[model samples]
Target: MTQTLPLPVTPLTAAQQTSLVNLVRRAAKTEILPRFRNLSAHQIDTKSGPQDLVTEADIAAEAMIARGILQLFPNATVIGEEAAAKDPSLRQKAAEAELAFIIDPVDGTWNFAHGLPLFGVILAATRYGRPVFGLLYDPMVDDWIIADDQSPTRIAGAGRAERPTSVSKPGALETLSGIMHYYLMPKDAQAKLAPVLPSFSRMGSMRCSCHEYRTLAQGGVDFNLSGILNPWDHAAGVLLCQQAGGVAKMLDGRDYNIAIEEGYILCAADQGTWDTLKTLLSPLYE
Candidate 1:
């Protein structure tokens, strides 16, 4: 993710950035927190499977965040995961938009639904299909991890100070550790990836990309491999990883884009670690 980017002529201005981050915090405070453990059985529903959940909280928070984004950048296209799921065409629209804000109201919906405090809200501002700005907000802690194409990743919140962050030092593959998504991949792909797991020190899925990327950016994790390529899920985290001095790309060596339909996203601490992991994962794409 730390590869050089074709940066936009202008990233979000300081005023805009501050306002947008506040908007996300407001949504979490007003919409998400209220419904966290308060979600009634009737307020929750399934999308793809039993574990794939959407609560009233997700819907309300997305609406709030989306509306606020529109007010600030009236011409920018805003695509929320929940909305795009109801209308697939929106994904294409966001991908091609001159400026688009991709929103994941709750990145760990399953965890949130089950009363886990590990969920988060993610927002990515892309120019055309490339992420130009990214925000990963943890509602529980009321703080955020943020980055732009040209800035180092920073952690900040209401009264908290902001500080730059980076990834961990590279380590041997057997000494390296991180998260890998398995169950979500196709059965054949799962079989191909399973054998590769034991080669690393540790591998598991938190069912949440938000915290996974946050951990990687803060030097707590060496790498992250996710099975899906949804824009809302990876766009922000990809930029977060890049700004934190980590390498991020599709298994095939392509830099990430909102237009990518399917592939694993592999993010690692630095070029050497990324190259090694990429070579090991090359077979899946090959």
Candidate 2:
């Protein structure tokens, strides 16, 4: 039985936007959830290079998401990781599309295969390259996190809400740097991070980008550090963070463009925290 999805309270009313997210969540739960356990082994492959990994579950999950989207919006283009890897031209089509679904069926394939419980299915509907609808589902936890610049929602075992309690802001990085992750920081840089803000705790890394951003939005984490960020990896979560009242940017405080292969990205609850981080990172990296 299909669940009754909540009504959209934001600018997006794309016929079945609510249902679409729910559909993806349900499909993820059905297909990927069962396989979370009882795994004998997983089939894997390399993409772009050996470090980037994809698995059978990732392919199957994206296909499931694509089929659900096409069934609802036949005209909308869908660009998925596995499919786009096989044919690069689809990426061009996605870039040009007025409406396209950008999807990474499993965001943390490494963790998923290892049964570390950090993998998820990520979907974002972009209008002319700007995300309008986004959903990230963790089948392991049975959690569905949804957000759009327009309408953002979280459905969890506890309950559902349009947004969390108002987002929080920390002092500038000069004072708050210790509370955030220092991506790709060298031992010298890492040591400096602690001394920069003796009052706060040093930052840590969550290998899964989606979870890191989610924690940032929820006020549980202060910043994200990633030397190499992927469009599919950060796209949905970035939109969600911005909508949830946080800010995301490159280390230089630049706009995030999905087309870019890598970014020294930072995610904070607000501008002040971002400014502090940017200032500290500037002289060091230079």
**1-286: candidate 1 lDDT, tens digit per residue:** 6889555643589789999999999999999999889988999999988988999999999999999999999999999999998999999999998899999999999999999999999999998889999999999999999999878899998798999999999899999999888888889988888788889988878888899899999999899988788988899899999989999988788889999898788999999999999888876887
**CA deviation > 4 Å runs, candidate 1:** 1-6
What's the TM-score of each model vs. the native? 0.96, 0.80
Candidate 1 C-alpha error for residue 267, in Å: 0.8
- Model 2 score (lDDT): 0.68
Q: How many residue pairs clash (N, CA or C atoms closer than 3 angstroms) in each of the candidate models, in the order given?
A: 3, 1
- Judge candidate 2 at residue 270 and give its lDDT: 83
- Which 10 residues in a row give candidate 1 its minimum summed lDDT? 5-14
What is the Cα root-mean-square deviation between model 2 and the actual structure?
A: 7.2
Candidate that scores best on lDDT:
1
